[model samples]
Target: MHFKDLFVNVSETLSFTTILLGVGYLAAFIVSVLVISENRSPAKTLAYLLLFFLLPFLGIIIYYVFGENYRKKKLYRLKALEDEKLQKRLNAYVYQRSEEKLKENELQLKDYEKLVRLLTYEGRFPLTDNNHVQILINGEEKFPVLFDALENAKHHIHIEYYIIEEGFIVDRLFDILFKKAAEGVEIRLIYDDFGCSLSKKFLKKIAEANIRAVPFYKIHIPFLSNRQNYRDHRKIVVIDGEVGFVGGINLSDKYQNEGMNNELFWRDTHLKIEGEAVRSLQLFFALNWSFCTDEGLFFQNEYFPKYEHAGDKKVQIAVSGPDSDHASIMLSYLSAISSARKCVYLTTPYFIPNESILNALKNAALSRLDVKLLVPGISDSRFVNAASQSYYEELLECGVRIFRYKKGFVHAKTMIVDDVISMVGTANMDIRSFDLNFEVNAVVFDEEINQQLKQVFLEDLHQSREISTAYWHRRRWFKHFFESMCRLLSPIL
Candidate 1:
């Protein structure tokens, strides 16, 4: 064939391939727009649209893998229905008692009553009194009490954790669990598959011991499932439905500084609760377990065994996740911050705040409320750290004192407002914790516990280096540029 004929054939083939590619891109873009338009967040929709238009093929793949709204998918509707039924069953007696108690102590709890009602009505969290709470500072303080509770459990033990790595602490806990299971005590354990990378054999071993161990939203094909992004980040352990533990510390050695690993000293906080509050924790665990395994669990008297009055502390267990339209935990935080009369103190490992929380903090600071934040000096994620730092200047300018914990990584997700209210649990100051991950927080309205947490905050402050407005503004140009880039991706981070 002649050269001219060959060139003409090649050009025709290229034209046909280009037309097909253009049609494919158009199809993908239309599908993306149709799917993403259902959500209410304009910023997130715009972000998705921009990514689709910029890189149609890869962007669609990424969105399919991580961007699907689990709430809209109705992934946890069954669990929610079960929860509603349980709530209805308990509503009559629980609310009546709660109201009577509130009226009796109206004068003392006047300031925190609104918050209690908010959680009760909006978050579906029950406010209960006659509870005892102990604040555990770190793993060193938390493990011993947790182990003792496990050893003493007489009935059933329920545990749900985000991460349960293979380590000395976990092994020790597992031994106790195995022994308890062998003793005919009911044991049900739920761990997030994405967060806990334990071997299948390990899970099988627990199952062989007659313990019901299930993974929360297990990934069947890993990269293909959108559920990988939404994790059960709660760390809860209910022993015999009487004593319970909840907080930021997972079952791992990193949380403990035994001079074994080269990692920095870890700081965290957890709570041990006894009395009616443990019933709430037990309910939370049962609901989550039912969600993960399709097991029908109902509230029974056995799970809420009558206990002697432990103390006079008031506590509520606030939960939030993608199952609901409202971010309950974030709303709770906003309520606490807005209601602050004297001060707001918080410590979190990640500090990527959404616009509402950011604005809340800024407004609180501008109002001359002593708003303070303690974050890690060295973060685990570079992108998250940069995104967190990007907001430092704005918060600092608004008089929100920001502190970088220099002694170690401050992993405690805790808050204290006006020495009247305290919150400690697994929710971080990030979008994921508020919207994607299932999180639980203990909201305590006891002045004694609040003051104790406040003192702990002051001690943490002594170890943290305050970030000055001038120093934050003096960052290098490249660093600012990088942070700005990371901030743009903060919505999905």
Candidate 2:
């Protein structure tokens, strides 16, 4: 055949194939919807089907990415009710035994008593005792403590992180874990697939060392399931039914700033808690384990031990996710912000906050509270970085002090309200953390904890570049265009 004839034939064949693929995809989606509807609520099924019909290819991609169906509200409501019933029984026991402890600590945190009760009612966490928390500022302070605790594990170790990669820091930690596993310590490990896709080989080495590892919401292949919007964004580590670590720090060299990706150092915060608070961390892990593997956790056996008084710091765990009707943990942060009487200091690598949070900060600052926000001078995501600036114009106009950490990126997710209360964990001030991703936060009502967090916040301010009204107004038109584009997709971003 002639060249023109061959080209025409190929073009026609490709077009026919495309039509067939699109039609097949639509049919399969329709079939999935019909099948899912039988086992799902009417409203839930309608929403899922509408999304698939409206977005077509992208919608199907979303369905396969998330780990579970949207029928979670009703299902998990039952689970939550069951959990709450058991929790009330435990709370009564804990409250009676720790009454004196609560009185002692509550007196110290009297300024935040109403705030704590308000959050407790919001279902973020219950009041607990014999809890001690340490704010780990960087990898320098966090990793060593984490490694030390993991090294001393006796009974069991459960960990779930958003990212775990093989690098100089992780390699040595893996070495310790391997030795511990050899010693017959029960080790359970989990990481998010989307966050740690490149770390698969690293996890393989862990598997070789006989550690039980699973990827959450996997997407590459052979994954049990995934939910596009439901991410396991939590970072938790519980060891020997005792010490635990929870914060924004991931297992990567960049977190330490010892290794740089593209010459930008990643900064973050991690917390080390020992005492009654560890029970809350352990419960958080167990619930996640049950969600991933369908194993119910009992308070008997070796899952929990008789936690005693240890350090003096008071800590509580706050949990939030898509499973909840509202983002309770994020709301608790808002409550803390509203409760601020003096200063509000916040640090996060990604500052792509939603409107409510932006308003919170703006309104708080306008109310004459010193609201200081710190983000990275050079962002890992330029689109979000630009959008982050768009709000700066408004925030600055309303008296919010904006600071860009110049020496390196401020990847820490931390906030201290009024130098009296502090919140530390995996949540960021964004739609993804509040609505889509599973997140955990530790709120400490101790004066010491808040002071330490404020100290770190102040030290970081030394290296931060303050944003003036003039600077934000001088942003170029093209940058503003991309900012607007990013803001439009903030829900998905």
Give the per-residue lDDT digits (tens) of candidate 2, residues 120-228. 6554355665777777877877888899888899988898988877677788787888999999998888778777644556667778889988777566553435544
Highest lDDT against the true fold, candidate: 1
Q: Whole-model Cα lDDT per candidate?
A: 0.86, 0.75
Candidate 1 to truth, TM: 0.93
TM-score of 2: 0.81
Q: Considering every candidate listed, which one attains the maximal TM-score?
A: 1
Where is model 2 more than 4 Å wrong at Cα?
1-107, 198-205, 220-228, 259-262
TM-score of each: 0.93, 0.81
Q: Which residue runs of candidate 1 sit more than 4 Å off their true CA positions?
A: 1-28, 78-87
Q: How many clashing pairs per prediction, in order?
A: 0, 6
For model 1, how does the per-residue alpha-carbon lDDT over 440-482 read when each residue is reduced to its tens digit?
A: 9999988899989999999999998999988888889999999
